[model samples]
Target: MIKVTDALNRFLFENTPVRGNAVNLSNTFQLALNKQNLPLGLKRALGELMAASALLTATLKMNGSLVLQIQGKGILKLLVVECNSEFGVRATAKYKGEIRDDQTLFDLIEHGQFVITLDPKDGGQTYQGIVPIEGNSISAILENYMLRSEQIDTKIWLSCDGNSAAGMLLQKLPETMNQSTKTDDAIVHDLDAWNRIGHLADTITDEEMLNLPIETLLHRLFHEEDVRLFEASNTKFFCSCTRNSVANMLRMLGNEEISSILEEQGKIDVNCDFCNTHYSFDKIDAAQLMVSDVAAQSSKEIH
Candidate 1:
């Protein structure tokens, strides 16, 4: 097996209006899990989404974050993965009941909604597109979204084997790809290339994807084509959970309740759902938090 690093590699077909990305996460996958003892089914599902999120984030090249989520009514309540501009990623899932190893992601979900959110870091309005989950695999569901919502022809392949997560994405560049005018033959040729490349990518196997390096994998798939591979960007585990955010959450529980808990336990502890980091506040820290919260609210009311 190849040494699969946590990175995203972009590529472009030299003569066709097509582009792609390949990503494999090993260390990132383990970090994303944060040592959570999860069922095999849910663990694999979350890993796949984490890989998919990295590909999509690279596609948009957005600054803030891109969130891919599935909300369902079955045993798997919610699964979400967020990837930021720097290729940092994190994922978490909420599920109950026994998720057997034999059951797949789709088998554990029911009447799920697939949501893609693009949140800009520059205080821009977040954009979300929601659609009913219609595919059995994460690849198919995201491809459907790209085709339906963006009208872009996209193909994605994702795989995870509890140890690592890997995926590849190919998109047929739309007409607005360039300002240069093209003749009808040029348009036809581009379409032909897109079809051929997609077919080649379809031949990838899960073992190859999870174990092969990105460039080697691409070479095997597109050996005859003129493909340019770009430098890879690292994908690492990152969680935005902070002490201040946890403090605000404690404030939401109300001062009375907070005091009651503190009086009983001598401290308050909060754990982030995304990453299993613990935020602990003893009496003094809790009291100061309450004092600031009250002062901020009072200032707001006065204004």
Candidate 2:
């Protein structure tokens, strides 16, 4: 029997300009999907996005979060997934109309836009990129974006079956040539190695990706190549929503808006889309928010 883990593994080829990451999201995927009442196709798409988000976040060298979003005008309205530098991930989807089991990616999202955002945790500036949706699969869409926008040669393989989501990413880094010691033959050799390894990774099957362990999969693909795999990093589902965050949002709405809602519905109920957690603010709670704000402002003025 093979042991499976929800972890991301990074590997590099010796003396080659190729690097890759493999992720298996068994437990994390299920956890993310626990409260979602999504259709089969949409659920699978969200899972793939979760896996891809993890793979992309692992490739970056930043202490921030990476968000992947797809918005469409068809039955599927939105699909969003976020992954931070620490390998934490969460995903959610919004859709209208009936979703058939046989729906394809294009069928679900007709006029879609793909958006990527990089948000730093330390109050740094955020960067965002948008591109018209292309291709039918998430892998093809992201591969196109990486090659066209970032100028990096990338290949991604993603698979999800509602139970498990897994993915592998292979990237060919830019070759750095030492003008003094580099030879034309060395550059040629590097290109050849990249092509060889990329083709080997392409031969991976969905079964192998979702079932095989990272070590077995790597060895199976690059048995003849010198591969160095780093320590495994755990991946899990995490939601950043909290009662304080909700309170802040309510405070922004002001006393008049909150009081109106309190009168009509007796309480304001907010549900987190990612985790489906419910937060309620009653009349007393609403009044207390304004009182606290006034106190804080008065204290600041006195100081």
**Candidate 1 residue pairs in clash (backbone atoms < 3 Å):** none
Q: Where does the lowest 10-residue lDDT sum fall in candidate 1?
A: 175-184
CA error at residue 302 for candidate 2, angstroms: 12
lDDT of 1 by residue, 1-303 (tens): 355599899888776678898999999999989567888878888999999999988888568999999998999999999999998999999988988899988888888999999999999899999999987888999999999999989999999999889999998886457222445456556768888898998999999899888767888999998788878999999999999888888889888999999999999988888888988999999999889889988999999
The reply for model 1, stretches above 4 Å from the true place, is 1-4, 175-188, 263-266
Query: Which regions of candidate 2 deviate over 4 angstroms?
Result: 176-188, 292-303
lDDT of each prediction vs. the true structure? 0.88, 0.89
Q: How well does candidate 2 score on lDDT at residue 251?
A: 83
Give RMSD (Å) of candidate 2 vs. truth: 3.2
Question: In model 2, what lDDT does residue 103 have?
Answer: 90
